[model samples]
Target: MSAAARAVVDTAALRHNLLSVREAAPGSRVMAVIKANAYGHGLVEVARALADADAFAVARLDEAVALRDAGLAHRIVLLEGVLRSEELSRAAALRLEPVIHCPEQVSALEQASLDNPLRAWLKIDTGMHRLGFPPGEAVGVARRLMASGALAKPPVCMTHLACADEPEETVTRSQLAAFAGAVADLPGDRSAANSAAILAYPESHMDWVRPGIMLYGVSPFEGRCGADLGLRPVMSLSSPLIAVKDVPAGGRVGYGGTWTADRATRIGIAAIGYGDGYPRCLGSTDTPVLLGGRKAQLVGRVSMDMIAIDLTDAGDAAVGDEVTLWGADLPVEILASRAGTIGYELLCGVTQRVAVSYV
Candidate 1:
C-alpha cells in the first residue's frame, strides 16, 4: 500500500474549461496562461491538454523554453519578457514572444542582434504598478520599437487588469480606457482580459484574451466558486484513510490538543497535510473533506504529513476509504475561503513529495 496522497489532474475537465473560456470570448483569440507550472497542474501536461488554445503565456523565459523543447508548436509568449541579451537571443531562437513591459526590455531587444527579428508585445501599465510602462508612454514605446527594427511585425499591445475580479471597483474600466487611449493609433492587435475579465467584462476582450486560473477551473472572483461560472474543476486531491479511532468525550486530538472532542467522536486519520500542498491554515476552521461521498469536518492542527477528520457523521467510513481534500464534489474555493487564502496558492503549493497522476 504505497498510496499516501495523490493529485489527480483531470484532462477532460481542463479541456472543458478551455471551451468555457472560448465561449466567454467567442470573438477574441485565447492565450491560455500556463505559468507557475500551469498553476501547479503540471506545465507540460497542461500545454498538451490545451493544444487548441490560440497561444500559451508563461511568466518566465524557461517555461516557454520548456514548451519549445517539448516540440509543442503552439505560440508561446513570455509574459515578463527578457531582462538580458542572452535571454532575448534564446527567445528569438525559440520563437517565443516576449512582452516588453519596461524600457530596459526594449533596449535589450534593440541591442541583441539576432538572425531573425522577434515578435513582441508592448505592455502598458494601466494601473497594475508591478510591470509595464506608463499608459501615456505606450504609443511612444511602440514607435521606438518599430524604428529599432527588432520585431518581425508590429508588436501586439496588452495591459493587465488589476481589479477585474472586484466588479465593484472602477479600476477595470479605467484600465480599459487607458489601454484604449494608449494604443489608439498603434498598428497591432490588443489583449487585456484575464480570467476575471473574460467572465465579467466583455468590453475588455479585444483582439485576444488571456485566461489563467479559469483554465484550471478555479474562480478568479471573490465570493464565488468555479461552478458559479460554468467551469469544471481539473485537480482533485485525495488520500486513503489509514486508520479510524474512537475518541472518548473530553479527549484531546492532534498536536497541541487544539481540537477537543466535545462528545464521543470517530476520527479518521488521512495521509494528507501541509507537506502535500494541503493548506496548513485550513484547520483554523471547520473545513469539510469528502469521505465515502459525505462531508467530514477536519479537526485539530494540520500536521506535516497527516490530518485528522471527524468522521463520526460519515456513516460506514473505514480504513482504506478515500478522502477527498478538494475536487469534483468538494470545491477548493470553499476550502480556500476557510483557510484564509486563495485557491491559487493551494493548487500551486502542492509539493513534489505528493505523487501526481494525469488522466
Candidate 2:
C-alpha cells in the first residue's frame, strides 16, 4: 500500500457482477458499458476482466480505439456513432459498430466508401430528448441506412431509458411501448434496458441489455444497494491515517474552525480529500468512514490533501491505521446521499491523482 490514497479494485467481484447481469437478462446479449474510463475503474483493466462479455459499449470513438489498441478483439459499439466522414472510415477500419442516432451520422455513413461495410445500431428517440431520431422517423431512417449499403447487415434497433430506476413512474413503460412500436417492423435485434431496466423491467430486455452502473456493483435505483441486488462492489477507496492527536474542549478542527470539540477526544487525519475525488461536502456532515473496522464521523472542512475524522468512537485508533471512505462494507450510495450526490457521480469523480490497484 502506498502512503497516499489508493483505490483497490476487485476483479473477482467485477466478474461476479457480470455473471449477475447474465442471470438477470439470460436471453439478452450483454453489452458492457465501459465508457468514461469504465466509470473511473480503469478502462482496459475492466475490459480485460469482462472479456467474456458479448460486446463493449463506449460513448466516444477514442475509448473504442483505446480498447483496440490494447489488443482486445471484442466487438465495440460506439454509443454516439460517428460525426464525420473520416471518423466513419476509421470506424470501419477498426470494425466498430456505431449507433446511428441522427441524420448527420447517417449522411456520414452514406457518403463514405469503406473497404468493408460496418455493423451499426439504429437509435430511436422514444422519449429521451438527448439523442436518436424521432420515433415517427424510425422506418424512414432504417430504409435510408439499408439503402446506403455501408452496413454489413441491418442495424440493431435501440433506445435509452429516461427513468427506468423509478419503478412507480409511467415514463419507462411508455418509452418501452414507443420503442417496441417504432421497431416492430424493423429488421435486426433490439435493446432498451440499462442497468435499472435489466433489474426492474424484464420485458425491456429484448435482444440486448446494456449494463453500466450495475457492472461496477453500484445500484441505479434509490433506497437500494448493490448487495440488495446481489451485486458485489468492485472498488474500495482507502487511505492511511497520517496523524492522530487529541483535541481539547473548545478546540477547533480543520479549515475555518468549523468544528469545535465539545469534550477532549482523539482525531485522526486521513490522507484523502477532494483532490483525490473524496467529496468535500462530506466534511462537517454526519458521514462516517471506517477506521480499523469501526465507524468514525467526519469533522470540519475537508482540505485539499487531508480530512479529519473524529475517532472518539473508534477504539484503539492510531497513526497508520487504514481508513476506508467507501467499499463493500460501507456502500458508496450512503456516502453519496450524505454528500448530496449519487453513486455514479462519486465513482466517476475519482481523479487520476489516486493510484488504482486491481486484485
Candidate 3:
C-alpha cells in the first residue's frame, strides 16, 4: 500500500490466460507477445509469469536483453527487429530472433560482422503496410537473406493481421492467402495469428501464434469481454475513496462544474485520475465504478489526482472505502469504451506514479 492507488496484478490469472491461449492454438507454438513493457504490466514480471510459453516476443532488442540479463533462458524474438549496426550487434550477441521487416534490416545484418550468427523471422506485408516486404518481393528477400550466411538457420516467415479483430473475415483470409503464397516455396516455419486470430480464425494459426492482449485477460473484439472469451483478468486497479460528501440538488462537482446534482446526492472522491493513467476522457455519467461493492456512476471531469463518483445509491459508502476502477467485477473494456479508447491503452497507460503489486 505504498500509494493510495494500486494496480494489483493476479499472477495466477495471467498463467490461466496463457493456458487458455494454449487451448485455443494447441497446434501452434505460443510466442507470448510481451511488448510495450508487457502492455504496462511490468516486462520482467510478465516474462517470469509466462515462463512456460514456448518463446517470448518483444518489440525491441533492449527488452530481449533485459530478459537475458534477468537469467531467464526462454527464446526471445524482437518483433520490430534491429535497425542499425549497434542494434544488430547487440541483438545477435543476445541470441535474439529479429523479425526482418525491411530491406535496410537485411542490409545491416549482411554488412555487420557479429560475434555470432542470428536466427530471424522474415516479415511479409500481406496487407498491413506498417512493416515487412510486399508479397511480390518477400520470397526474393528471404532468398537473399539466406544466401548472406549471416543467419544461423533459415528465417521463419511471418506477417501481421490488419483486421483479425473484425468479424468480417475477408481481410484476414486475404492476408493469410497472401502470406501462404509468398512463402509457398520458401523453407521455413510460418506464423500469422495474433490475439484475435488465435480465437476467431483457427486456420490462421500456423506454426506459431503470437498472443498479446489476450494474455493480459483483455478481449480484442468490440462486443465481447475477456470473460466471454474464457479469460480471467490479470490487472485489477483499485483506489481508496479519500473523501465522502453530501451535495445538494443543483450543486456542481469536479473541474469546470461539468456535473450538477439533480437531487441531494452523496459523492465519493477517489484517489485516482489521468495522472495515474485513468483516462481523463472518461467524463460520462454512465461510467460506473465499484464503490463499497456497489455500482456508482462517475460524474463531472476527471482531474489529475482524483475523480468524483456519484455514490448516492450506496448510502453505506464511507471514507477510505475501496473503489474498483476496473477489475474482475468491473470490465476495463467497458471503461475503455466510455473513455473513447481501448482496453490496451487503459492497461498500458497506467503511469509509474501508481504502485503495482503482484498477487
lDDT (C-alpha, whole model) for all candidates: 0.91, 0.93, 0.91
Model 3: per-residue Cα lDDT over 36-131, one tens digit each: 889989899989999999999999888898899998788899999988988888888878899999988889887888889889999999988899
lDDT score at residue 21, model 1, on the 0-100 scale: 92
lDDT of 3: 0.91
Residues 26-128, candidate 1: write the lDDT tens digits: 9999999999999999999999999999999999998988898898998899998988888888998889999999888878777778877999999999998
Error of 1 at 74 (Å): 0.9
Question: How does model 2 fare in lDDT?
Answer: 0.93
Write model 2 residue lDDT over 144-219, tens digit each, in one string: 9989999999999999999999867699989998998899889889999999999999999999999999999999
In Å, residue 182's CA in model 1 sits off its true spot by: 0.6
Clashes of 1: 0
Clashing pairs in 2: none
By lDDT: ranked, best first: 2, 1, 3
Candidate 2: minimum summed lDDT over ten consecutive residues — where? 279-288
lDDT, residue 324, model 1: 95
For model 3, the stretches where C-alpha displacement exceeds 4 angstroms are 1-3
